[model samples]
Target: MFSKLVNPKSIAVIGASHNPAKIGYVVLKNLVSHNFKGDVYPVNPKGGEILGYRVYKNVEDLPEVDLAVITLPAELTLKVFEDTAKKAKFIIPIAGGFGETGKKGKEMEKYILEKAREHNARIVGPNTVGIYIPSTGVNTALVVPERSRFPGDGDIAFITQSGALGLLTMDSVSLYNVGFSAFINLGNRVDVNENELLEYFGKDEKSKVIIMYIESFKDGKEFMKIASQVTRKKPVVVLKAGRTSRGGKAASLHTGALGGNDAVADGAFKQVGVIRAYDEVELVDYARALAYGKPIMGDRIAVVTSAGGVGVVTTDYIESKEHGIGMKMASLDEKTKRKIKDEVVPFASVENPIDMTAQASDDDYDGVLEALQSDPNVDAILVYALFQTPLISEKLVDIITKWHRKGSKPLIVGSIGSNFTMKMAAKFEENKVPVYMSIERAVKAIKVLRIRGKYIERWENE
Candidate 1:
C-alpha cells in the first residue's frame, strides 16, 4: 500500500489543465519543478495540452497509471475515481464536500468506498491537500506553489488533518532550513486515518520523529494502543485541536471526525507517552528540537545567565513543576557555589539559578558554563545572554561555539536583545545549540525532550 501510494513510478492528474492558477495546473507545475522522476499524464475532458504534455480526455484513455490524483469538483469526483481505478491501484481525492458536509456527504463517501472495494483500490482522502515523498520525488498536492521544491530528506515525518495547515507548517520548517522525510495531509479521512499512518511511519527507517496536527479521532482505543507502542520507539508529538465544545462540533463538520471527550483524549495521549503541544508554534518547536537536539536525561536544570530577569523566569518555569512530571531547579553544590563566587564578582549570587549579573565578562560566562556542565546534579543547562554588549556578544559566541562543540548535555540559550541576539542565535544554530526567544519556550522544549528520551530509553530496555 505504501509503495504504490508514495513510490509510484507513474501518475495521472485527472483534472489537469493549462491554467496556472488552477489546482491541477499547480500540481503539475510542482511535479515538473521538483524534478519528479516518473511518467506524468494529464487527464481532463476539456484539456488539450499542458506544459508541453498531451492531455487525455479521461483516465481510461491513459496508457498506464499507478496513482491517480483527482482534482475535480465534488459532484464529478466519484466518476473520476471509478475511471482511474481501472488503471491505478491508488487514488488521491483532493476535493471537499464529502463526509465532512452532512448526510449528503456521507452518501457520497459511501459511494466512493463501495467503488474502491470493488476495484481493490485504496483512497487517500476525499478532502485533502495531498502527499509528498521526498525520496521518490512524488508530490501529489494540488495547491503546491509553482516554485515549491522537494524538502531535503530528514528524520521527521509530518502528518496533519488540515491540508492547508500542514503545508504551512512544512513551509515554516523549510524556512528554518529544516527538511522532512514525508508529509501526509489526511483531510476528511475516509479510508486512511491517523492510526494507520502512525503505524506505517513508526516502522519507517527514514522517520525518527513523527509530528501530527489532529482535529479529531476515529478510534480512541486503537489510536492510544498504537501511539503507545510507537512513541516507545520514537518521539510522537501531537497538536490536538477541538478542546472546547464548540470547537469539537466545528471539527466534526470540518473532517467528519469524532472529536470525542477532550479531557479523555488528553489523558489517553499522556497514558501512551505522547507529548501534546498547546499551539502551532510550540508544535513546530517540539518537532524541530526532537529532530535535531539530543534527548535530555533528567529534569534537574541549571540556569547560567548574564540577564538576571531571564534567569529568574527560567527558574520560575523549571521550578513551577507544570510539565509532565514537573522539573525542578537543581541546587548548586557548595564546591560549585564557591567556584562561582571565586570566578564571579563578590556581589554575584551563587545559587541554582545563578545570576552572573550585568558585570559578567567572557571569562565569567565560561566559568559559570563550565561549573554547570561539570556539576553532577545538573542534567541540563540554560545559558541566557552572554552578548549584552557588542564586544561581549562576539566573545560569548566564540566561547559558546567552543563549549558547544565539546558539550554532551543539552544546552539552550536565550538572547536578551534583538540585534545582538539574532547574531548570537545564528552562531548558536551553526554550533548546533538550540536557542529560544523566551525562557518559557526553552523550558517547554526541554520538558518535551526529557519525556521523549525517557520513553526511548524504556523502549530500548524492554
Candidate 2:
C-alpha cells in the first residue's frame, strides 16, 4: 500500500485548478513542473482545462489512476473520496478542519475513513502537505517548487505531522545540499499512520536512515515494538513535540493527539534504542550524523581544534551528563601523543582537547587526525576546523572527507563562522563528513550516535 502511494505511475488531481494562489492549483503545478513522470488528470466541478489538462467535471467521470489527491473543503472531501476510491489505488486528502477541529470534524473524518475501507483503497492523509519521493519525481506537496525547492535524492527518509514545518525543514535542508530519499507527512492520519510507513520504509533499499517529527504516537505499543526492531537495523531519530502543558494544548489542537507525560515518552524512546531530538536543528543534526557518518562506538571523544575556545567548549559538552548521557573526554594513548607532538608545533597541547592554536595549518589538522584515528583509546574524532586560520584552505575539507570515506573511525568536523564559512562547511557536507557550525551542536550529534551504539549493544546481547 505504501509502495503504491510513493510509486504511483498516474495520479488524478481531484481539485486541480489553474489559479496560482490556491493549494489545489499549486499541488498540481508542483507535481507537473517538478517532472513527475505520471499522467496528471485534473478534476473540478467546472468543466474547463487547467494547465492544459482537460478538467473532468466530477470525480466519478475521471479516468482510473494510481493515486487520487483531494484538495477540497473538509465537508466536501468525503463525497469526492466515495466517488474516486474504487478507481484509484491510493487516495490523499490535503485539507485540515478534520479531526483536529472538534467533535463534528471527527465525525466527518470517520465518514471519509469508512469510504476508504468500503472501497479498500489506502489513504495517505486528510491534512498533509503530501508525499515526496525525489527518486521517482513524485512530489504531492501543496507548495510550489520555485520558492521552496525539493530535496535531491539521499539516504535519509523523513516523516512529519505538520505540513508547514515539513516544507520549511525540506527547504532549509536543501540549502546545505543535504538531501532525502522520501518525505511523508502523516496528517490527521484517518487510515494510514506512521506504523505502516515505518515498516515499509524500514526495509526500503534507498533509505539508510529514518527520521521523524511526531506530535504523538497513534499506537504506542505497536510503535515501540516496531521501533525496537528497526533500530537494530538502522538508526531512527525523532523530535517529539508538546512537552509542556501549553505546548500540549497546541499540539492537541494541531493534530488531535493527547500529548502525554514528557518523561514517559523520553524513557520509552531510550528503551527502544530510538534517539530523541528536542528541536528542528537537533532533528536535522542527528539525521545528518546517522545518514552519512559512522556509528559513534563510545563516548570517549577526542577534540582537535585550531581554536582553543572551541576545544574547551566542546570538551565541556562531552564531560557534562545532560539527560544521563555519560560521556568522557578520551585519554590519548602515549603512542598517539608522541605522533601528535612530532607532527604538530611544540607549543601545541598534546593532551585531550588538543589545541593546535590559531597558527595551525591544514598540515597540523592532518597530522593530529591521523594520530587520533590510530589510537585504540580514542573512539571518535572531533576536529574544530576554524576556516579563519590563514593556512587552512579548501584542502581541509578533502582531508576530513578522506577519513570519513575510509570508514576506519568516525570523524566529525566543527567550524563556526559567517556566510564565507558556511560555503566552506557545505563542501564538507558535499563530501559527507557531517560538519556543524557549533561545537555544542556538533557534540550533540555525536551524543546521539553514542546513544545508538549503546542500544545496539543491547540488541547484539539479545
Candidate 3:
C-alpha cells in the first residue's frame, strides 16, 4: 500500500509556486536539493517554470505519477485531489484546518477518504508536513533548511502523528550522529494511520528500529496486535502523548486525536514488548542504543569512569528500582580486577565502577575496557570519559571506538560538558559508539537494551 509513497518513481507538486514563503516552493527546493533521482512534475495554473522544471497548467495534462503532493488549503485540496486521484497512486495533502477545526473540517476529511477509496489511492494526510526518505532523496517536509537539519540515511524509521513536533524532535537528535531511513508525519490521519504504517515498516529492510511519537492510537487493539508481531523482529520505541487528562484534552484540540486511559495504554505497551519513552530524550536515547549498541544479554553491568562522583550516581541509577528495569553492578573476576589494577595506577578502583581517577590516561581506559570485555561476569559496561581532565586527550574517542567496534559486549559512554565535550561525544557516535550526556541517560539506555534483549531471548527460547 505504501510502495509508491516509499519510493515514488515520479512526483507531481499540484500547487507548485514561485513564492519563497510558500510551502510548495520549499517542497520543490527540498526535492531538488536532496537530488531526487526520479522525474519531477510541477502542476500549477500559472504554467511557468519553477527551479528549472516546467510547470503543468493542469493535473489532467500531466502524465500519471506515483506521488502527488497537494500544498493548498483544505477546501482547495479537494478540487485538486479530484484531478490527481486517478493520476497518482499516493497523495499527500500538506494543509492544516481539516478535522482539527471542528464539524465542517471533519466532513471535509470524510469526503477526501471516500474519494481516496473510490480511486484506489492512499492518502498520507490532509494536514501534514509530509514524508522524508533520505535513501531515496524524497524530502517533502515543511522545515526551513536554514533553521533545522535533517538526518542522513540510517537504520531508524521515525513515525509521528504531529508534523511540527516530529520535525522538531528529528532536528533535536540530528546532531547526535544518528541517521533515519524515513520520517513519516501522519497529520489528522484522514486515511493512512499508524497501525498500517507499523506493519509496513516492519518489513522495511533499511529500518532496523522503528520509533514513533504518537498522540493517540487510531485503533488501540489493532496497534497492539501489529506491534506485538513487529517487536519479535526489531525494536519499537514509542513516546505516547496525552498521558494526563489535561494533556488528553490538549491533544484532541491539537490533532483531533481522542485520548485514552494512560494506565491502560501503559499496560498494553508492556504486553506488546513496546518500550515506552516518557519524553523526547528517552525516545532518542532508546533508539540510539537499540540501533547501535549490542544486545545486552544480562542485567549485570560494570562502570568505568574517571570521576568518582559520576560512578557513584551511575551506581545509584543501576540499582534504582523506580525505573522498573532492574540492573545491578557486576562483580569483577579476581583476575580481571588484578589485571585492571596493574594496568592503571595501584590506587585506581578495580571494583564494579573502576574509577581510574582523573590522572588516568587514554591507555588506562583502553586496557581497562579490554579487561571488562573479557570478564565473564560483566554483561555490559558504561564508561565516563570526561575530556576536561588533564590526562585524557581526543585520542580517547578512537580508543573507545575501537573497543565498541570489537562488539565484545554492550558499551555506553557518558561525558557531560559544553563545546569540547559535545564535540568528542559526536565523534564517539560517528564511530558507532552510543554516548549519553549524563549518567542517568546512559543507565536508562542500558535498561532499554536489556528490555529488548529479554524480548528476543524469550522469543528464541519459545
Candidate 4:
C-alpha cells in the first residue's frame, strides 16, 4: 500500500511549468533542487523547458514513473489521473475545491476513489500542499525553496492535517534544527488516511517517533486499533484539533473534520497510548524528547541546576496538581551526595535539585550525573545550566552528550539565558539532548518521557 507513494523510484509532474507563479514550477523545481535520486519528468501540454528538464506533452509521452503529482484544477486533476492511473502507481492532486467545499466537490472525490480502485493506484490528497521525505530527497511541498529552507533528516515523521501547522512548526524551530524523516500534509484525505500512514511509518526504520496534527479521523476506531500497535513499537504524538467550544465548526471548515466529542476522543487516545499535545509547543517538545531521550522507567527525577530558584520552580511544576504528571522530585542517595561533595564546590547542594551554583565546574555536573546513572531511585535527569556562570565551559557539552548516549534514562537540559546560552544549548541538541529555555518546558518534556514510561509499563503488565 505504501510502496510507490512514500518511496517512488520516479515521478512525473503532471502540470509542470516554467512559470515562477504556478504550483507546477515549484513542484518540479523542488524535486530537482532537492536532488531527488530518481527519474523526474515534467509533464505539460505546453511542451517547454523547466529547470533544464524537457516538459512532456502528456503521461503517454513520458516514461512510466512510480508517482505523478497533478497540480491542475480540481476537475482537470481527475482527467489527468484517469490517464495516469494506468501508468502511475501513486498520484497526488494538489488542488482544492474537493469534498471540503460542497456536493460537487464530494462527487469529484468519489470519482478519484473509483479511479484509484479501478487502476489499483492510490491518491495522497485532493487538497494538500504535499509531503517531504528528506532522506529520499522527496520534497513535494508547494513552498518555493528561496522562501523556505527545510529541516535536515531525523527520526520524527511528522504529518499535519493543516499544511500551515507543519510549515509553522518547521519555521519556528529552524534555529533548533529539528530534523524529520518525513513531513506530510493530508488535506481533505481522499484516500490515504492516518490508518494507512501509521502502518507504513510504524515499521519504518528511519522513524523512531511519529507526530501529527489531526483535526479528526476518518475512521476513529480503525485509527485506535492501528495506533495501539504502532505505539507499542515507537511513540505516537497527536495534536487533535477542534476539541474546544467552537472546535467542531472550526474543524469542519478547516479540514472538514467532524470534531467528535472531546471526552470520548481523549479517553480513546489515552486507552490506545497516544500522547495528546494541547498546543503547538508541546507538539514539537514531546516529539523532540521522545525522539532524543529514552523512556523514563519511573517518575523519580533528578533536577541538576546552576540556579536554585529555577530548580525549585521545575520541581514544583512536576509535583503540582494542575500539571497532573505523576512525578516525584528525587532524593539523592548517599553515594551520589558523596561524589558531588567531593567534585563540586563546598557551598553547592548535593540533594534532589543538585544546585552546583555559580562557581561549580563542568566536572561537578558530570560527577553527579555519573553518580545518578547508577542510582536505583532515579529514572530521569533535568539539567539547567545558566551559561553566564564564569566556570561553565564548553566541556559540559561532552558530559551531557556522553550521558545521553548511555540511554539508561531520559536526560533534558533546561536553561534560561540570552543568545550565547542558545548557542551553547545547540551543542547539547546536536549531540541528541533536547534543550528548553523555560523550566516549564523542560519539565513538560520530562513529563512526556514519564507518560511514555507509564504506558510502556502498562503494556508490560498486560
On lDDT, the candidate that comes out on top is 3
Candidate 2 TM-score to native: 0.92
Count clashing pairs, candidate 4.
Answer: 0
- Against the true structure, what is each candidate's TM-score? 0.83, 0.92, 0.94, 0.93
Query: Model 2 scores what on Cα lDDT?
Result: 0.82
Q: Give the TM-score of candidate 4.
A: 0.93
For model 3, state the Cα shift of residue 268 in Å. 1.3
Candidate number achieving the greatest TM-score relative to the actual structure: 3
lDDT of 3 by residue, 22-126 (tens): 998999999999989999999889998999999999999989999999998888897877778989889999998889999999998898888888998889987
Candidate 4 lDDT score at position 424: 74
The TM-score obtained by model 3 is: 0.94
Model 1 poorest 10 in a row by lDDT: 252-261
The clash tally of candidate 3 reads 0
- Tens digit of per-residue lDDT, candidate 2, span 177-245: 787889999899888888878887788888888988898788989989999888888888888997644
User: What local distance difference test score does each model get?
Assistant: 0.77, 0.82, 0.88, 0.84
How should the candidates be ordered by lDDT, best one leading? 3, 4, 2, 1
Identify the superior model by TM-score, candidate 1 or candidate 4.
4
In candidate 4, which residue ranges exceed 4 Å CA deviation?
Answer: 244-260, 323-326
Residue lDDT tens for model 1, 4-56: 77778888988887888888888888778667888899988886889878898
